[model samples]
Target: MITDDTTVNGVRIGGAEAGSDQGARTIELPSGARAEVRKGYGRDLMRAQRATAGGDANAVVFALIAEVTRVDGRKIVYEDVLEMDLADVMALQAEVIDENFDRPPQRASQASSNQDSQSRS
Candidate 1:
């Protein structure tokens, strides 16, 4: 989990999830930087996984990075990660994904609890 004090490039990064919206988060990096990271709707991640299965390591890495990281209020794409030096930002991107990806939103848990109660009644 990313804490509010987790800093990359001197800026803090944090994690948040609300309702069933998985694609809502805030990412902060160095150099007066901040971004809104969100979960990809699984299509891109599936495509990336397929590429990896086909022996495309580069594709998978960039795909995962792009799927999770956003910058300047825009979704980062494979081309975007390719244009930049991986050494500079890969760790930060990976950290954001590791901390925030693939988790059920808070509302989903609540809804499940509600369903369980109704089922028991």
Candidate 2:
């Protein structure tokens, strides 16, 4: 859902409410249940996560923390912060397109197998 206005760490955050990332992940399976790996950094990653919490958190907590820690000598601007969101949306769209409509590989492989079988016969 989209949020018209919200505050986080005092800055007004607009655009979409930063939704939590969720997806299937793989692990050691005991039986028939399928799984996938939803990638994330370890708890040492909380500072990075604050960026997604929106508003000043991106620059205040995440950006500043990284700068102070000397992770990088850079400042996260407003557009840069928003690009993170835009990037994710594009990534999600690619995955959805691949899952739903990308069948060229499968079709080509199957066709190759059929040609091989016909030649052998």
Candidate 3:
């Protein structure tokens, strides 16, 4: 039963404060079920990439999840698709990848700006 103000681990999802720390965001499905999304750590990403390269969808999905805060309230601290349907799993994967994809561009642009300033100095 996800409300508009749903939160996971005390962080609001779908709000301006979402993804504020540890890349946390709340993912609410139309079925009134919700899950928290977080960016995977380095090893998680590495494993996910490897699994993706090997065409193992299950492993890839598992690698992207950091926690499931809403599903069972069990504080599961890893990818566990046993209770999640395909839609939820896919959504989690997409959110994780999207969050990861967004960071590099900003960093690259910032680096470029720094280099430009140094050159001007």
Candidate 4:
């Protein structure tokens, strides 16, 4: 269960979900509903993969929401997410992508070093 101050992957998650801000871990919809999102792990990804076996991009997003998020601190299923309003659904999707896929920017020096190393190999 995620609380107001839960930290996932060393990033503290709190407040309403915002765009490109890594500190938010909660999704707030225009309808006043809220969901607490947790950082996804391998098992969660496996579950999402199984739920979205048809290769549907939208289904994959909903499946991940089902496997990794909680509404009012209770676990929700894929059907629940599907039943939500499009705005809410999209908000959840954005949060899920941020939680699972967003990465910190690589330093320019590191990028250059990697490129140099690759060229030498």
- Of the candidates shown, which would achieve the greatest TM-score relative to the real structure? 4
Write model 2 residue lDDT over 1-121, tens digit each, in one string: 4464676674335542232124422332233222232332233245455554665443443332221121022333324434444444333334323332325553557889999999999
Better of 2 and 3 by TM-score: 3
Q: What ordering of candidates by TM-score runs from best to worst?
A: 4, 1, 3, 2
TM-score per candidate, chains pooled: 0.48, 0.20, 0.45, 0.62
Alpha-carbon deviation at 34 in model 2, angstroms: 28
Candidate 4, which ten residues in sequence have the lowest lDDT sum?
15-24
Question: Could you list the CA RMSD of all candidates, in the order they appear?
Answer: 14.2, 15.1, 10.8, 9.3
Q: Which ten residues in a row have the lowest lDDT in candidate 1?
A: 11-20
Quote model 1's TM-score: 0.48
**1-121, model 4: which lDDT tens digit per residue?**
5565576665445642223234337767777887877777666676688888998877887898887777776678899998989888888888888555669896679889999999999
The parts of candidate 4 lying over 4 Å away from their true place are 1-24, 99-102, 106-121
Model 1: CA > 4 A from native? 1-23, 49-54, 85-88, 102-121
TM-score of 2: 0.20
Q: Per-residue alpha-carbon lDDT of model 3 for 99-121, expressed as tens digits? A: 54456443557889999999999
Point out the higher-scoring one by lDDT: 1 or 3. 1
